[model samples]
Target chain A: MGKYRPGRRALTGATIVAAASLGLAACSSSGSDDSPSDGASAAGGSDVELRLAWWGSDSRHSATQEVIDAFEEANSGITVVGEFSDWGGYWDKLATATAGGNAPDVIQMDQLYLASYAEREVLSNLADYSALDMSHLGDSVLGMGQVDGAQYAMPISTTSFTLLVNQDVLDELGLTLPDTDAWTWDELGEFASSVTEASSGDVVGIGPMNNEYSLQLWARQHGEALFTDGNVSISEDGLASYFQLALDWAQSGAGAPADQYSEQAALTLDQSDFATGKQAMSFTQSTQIAAYTTASNGANLVPVKIPTEDANATPYAYLKPGMYWSLSSQSKHPEEAAQLIDFLVNDPAATSIIGTERGLPANPDTVEQLSGNLSPEETKAVEYTETLDPILGDAPEIVPNGASDTDPLIQRYLLEVMFEQSSPADAAASFISELQSSIDAA
Target chain B: MSLKELNALAANRSARRRSGGKADTRDNRAALGFLSPWMLGIVGITLGPLLYSLYLSFTNYNLLQSPSWVGLDNYERMFGDERLHQALKVTFTYVIVSVPLQLAVALGLALALDRGMRGLAFYRSAFYLPSLLGGSVAIAVLWRLVFGASGLFNVILGLIGIESSQSWISNPDTALWTIILLHVWTFGSPMVIFLAGLRQIPRAYYEAAATDGANVWWRFRHITMPLLTPIVFFNVVLAIINSFSNFTQAYVVSGGTGGPADSTLFYTLYLYQEGFGNFRMGYAAAMAWLLVLIIGAVTAINFWLSKRWVHYDD
Candidate 1:
């Protein structure tokens, strides 16, 4: 019995060991199998496959995939794999990829992060590739990509920050849209209050001002910039007035109440108070007029210039780069990557497929070609851009490395003031100090 | 005849021992073979990253560029970081408030369910459903719908003529409490543990106590409570750890910014913001290690204190 016991135990142990080893082997072997395919594709060998990644909606993704198919058809050897996600997930995934030294060959970049990536040298200089066409892009638009005199990204499109007004809400309240072109900040506040009072508070006159872009425009109107040469340059007084304006609007019942405003602020684009016709007006990017109009269920959403303190003297608008296409510094086939970007910019077929999903194309030829096919909302945005071209202020300086931190800091302070946890002056002071420290740390 | 049989038995034992050594060696090899996968996982997946993060905590790794050694700078920065203090305070408040409330609810339900009842399995599953779905993003989204300005809660209030327009989750004063309520709603796991612990308390003890004229509360206090201490300790430790590391509900409800003035900024969420949002991975790694140490210390204290209050039948 003792002799048999030892043998049985040994056999049982062997079986368990063999089973576990096989399980682990199965896991590791499968993992390793995936790496070689990625490695081979990234090596720019005979196949010359490239991975391109971007963040956008479903329509944008389908449009971009169509463009990729076209690129692949034109250059048979070069197959471009598309990776896309919504806005929030994109940055995290990109950061992880870049950290692991496995970033996609081509990437969609944002202005807020343009300088950050450029300073980190994660982006390859587009100027280094003469094969890519830059002659089609004008200096002002092209300059958006220049950091320290090296072009690390190329502008895909341009958009301006604007006020989107819901005409239906105004009509319901028996109020006409205010004159956006000549209205001062004070007059705008009164106009919002008048609408709210006229509507008996069923509809708010405006949503809360939570956007940092609005603050930037306000600062620019006061002859200051949010950031200058990599440090926060907006003064405390400028920031305080901006906060005070929002506070006054809220207190006067022009904007949604603080708690309701925060709830609205937390919602997605389609769920916004303005989009749902709960508010008559909200700050929005010009490129988003189409989306807002759609979300509003055919409500007459119109794009108007942001109201300024003095529109004639202080031109607070600029043609901001909607987004940029960049090549990763770790890309193996940068020349091919540049060629694809050039195609995306210059090819009318590709532009037709992309079709202002990214906003108006940066290339003038593509814009002119697509002029006859513009949606009514797109036409309004284009005309608005044309009117502002002569009067727009200088583009704000490229955002600094730590500018991402500023958005949350601004939101926190905005909430603090709205909740009466702190006075506007105190919140503004705290915001400036925190923003400065963030920038300094970067 | 007896002596010769005993001698033969001894000889057989000695022979078996000599051969058993060889079998033991084989068994050891087999056992090692089975353990190899788990050992490999520990070394490759867990230990590898843990050690790397420990090293990263001492360096200036920004996820974009190669790390540079900056010994103790990241840790030192935590001492002066106001946001860190805010996150810590928020997490502790959440833990302190949610743990006891959850355990009490769990224990109450557990005791009631311990009474013999009809459809016991169905009730158990129904009660356990919230815990199954507690940390999910869907529940968080549903929470927003239930607590928004025009949400179900306000609608109910309106029907009763209360006429309030406050967005409960967005109000700074009430936002953290909304999350805590969500935490307390998921008491199923601890309730199940408590139910099992109650069953283990000898029914005969209660019977004897009844003879002594003890009421339901009195019997529960002396007999059931004493026996359930170990389970309560287990639940408390787990509840504290879970609350400290909670991220999904807070992240989803606050729209990933921990907003309305950072009121719901759980420590894990703040660490995530620093690591992923701000790209300050080194600082985040330090925060991660600090969280680990805090949880570890708390758990150790819990165990040490368990000796006094936790009763064991054996």
Candidate 2:
């Protein structure tokens, strides 16, 4: 009887533990109902503590943290707590927090979600942010933060899709560097093949992740927009050409072997075989170039423009803001937050401290103020931009509502093709059908 | 009978009854007091949101806009969605292979460590440490590095005169298996449970079997096997539940794509990608409910089967 009593007690104990565990996990996993986005506040002059959330690598985190510290030091009344994570978990955590009504006061907004967040009314409109004299900022960069005639976020520094080359690999093959301004794919492919042949199995010619976005640069250079008004705009032949180039590189031992494509399919620019010197070339953004340069011995790296499909093809390089910062509508201190953003964007001291870390400064005045303090690599990148004369495209259209969800569906098809299991014909068909179905459902 | 004897007997009976009733009341109050935090938590948090999600599972919830009731529309869509089918296939394969393999290895390890060895705690802790970090971001990242095409594993093979081009985690044929191996490697938690079960068996049973001239194998077959059945059942149930719901490892290892054509797409990862990544919260809610049902049914089946085989010695 006594034993049975203890067992009954144990069951009660187990129930308690289970309930508590569930509560804690639930709280951790979801957004707070009390989050300020919808505008409810407990009565108090109690000093406000706001969380500022972002995703970045260590350097960005540290630099942003320093800037936050400066903001706090200058504005003694408000305390800002920063919440950060790497890219993989950032959105999940952010969404969970947002749902729970515990969203951060200031959010680092990706272009992909800027429109979605705005449409959902989760983001505060920044119509008055323009009043801060951001006219000094690059209009091209600022354009990305605008969606449907409303500004939901302020433009941060800007970057463009660019290419990185291994100069040592080029030299080893007795090949001169391709002219950044006038290079074509046939010229580059021949150079790539020569480099691969000379490396004697030590290096491959190129390594691109199985991403449609990476191919968009070349597609854009041919004056083909990857998507237009909810439809894929690139021709079937264009996709075939893109895949064929990748297949040719693989077959010629100038790129990752077919079996190894999966390994490289999902890599960030940092872990790319090119960055680690396992390959000769990689396509990425100017922001990502910093990672590749820092990861490799500096002597062999060079920033170059992505080549055009043909001689007459435009050297299309879309320069746009990498991300944006926005004050939440729920924030009681929007005025103060706006002031901090202005300081971060246009102040000479903050610009110098931040440098091109966020990318090139979006503020034209800040760019002018900070140019003297730019690192050699950053300066080289800025100089390389002028030489490419890239045909600037419009800011990627606000990734349409639910398009963020559908982007990976497209990538999956591309990956299947790249790994040699599927033809581009089958891949494109499946991708278009799948995405269309999803879009229709949405 | 004498008056004193009669008085003593009456007093003893009354004392016994009073004590029993008092203990019952005390236990009732104490149990409620101890459970106050949990009762509050469940009503305020778990039960509240779980019921809300149950409502959402039936709705057309985009999460950005308020959820609208859609009467099984989400469930209906799931059957037609190829991604959901693919996710189910991947998740089932992961659970079916990883759970049993993990238990088998854990049981083998527990048997090996049953001997009271020197520095036992150190060995136990060393073996158990991976379980602590089994779901961590670092381990997932390490999994990528070790299984990468030009990684330490391939480099080691090259040193031993073997040519290999296997990027195990990224290879569609092999990515799922790499994740299974990672799941199996964290068998320490179950091993510890098995160790506690081992200590509960009476030494006399083995001794008596030995006196019957039974060898070590026979003794173990008769003694240890039956004695550990309950714990084995417990571990199997727990492991299957844990394995079926794995997310972080797959999420991180696959770079949140669940790629190589969704080969490493565990069920929970798919749910998360749908819910959070795609913002198909209603569809994701449906997936989550399905997971709960599947896990619950499997566990119930396990318990029913355990009644036949799990010997709990009195």
Q: Candidate 1, residues B201-297: lDDT per residue as tens digits?
A: 7677889999999999999898889777867776887787778788889999998878788899889889988887888899998898898778778
Taking chain A of model 2 alone, its TM-score versus the true chain A equals 0.82
Model 1 steric clash pairs: A17-B34
Number of the top-ranking candidate, with lDDT as the measure: 1
Q: Could you tell me how far off, in angstroms, the CA of residue A220 lies in candidate 2 after the best superposition?
A: 3.4
lDDT at B201, model 2: 74
User: What is candidate 1's lDDT per residue for A208-271, written digit by digit as tens?
Assistant: 5666677778788898998887888889899888788778888999898888888865666778
Best by TM-score: 1
DockQ scores for all predicted structures: 0.31, 0.37
**Would you estimate the TM-scores of all the predictions?**
0.90, 0.84
- Candidate 1 chain B lDDT trough over 10 residues, lowest sum: B305-314
Docking class of 1: acceptable
DockQ, candidate 1, comes to 0.31
User: Could you report the Cα RMSD, in angstroms, for every candidate shown?
Assistant: 6.5, 5.3
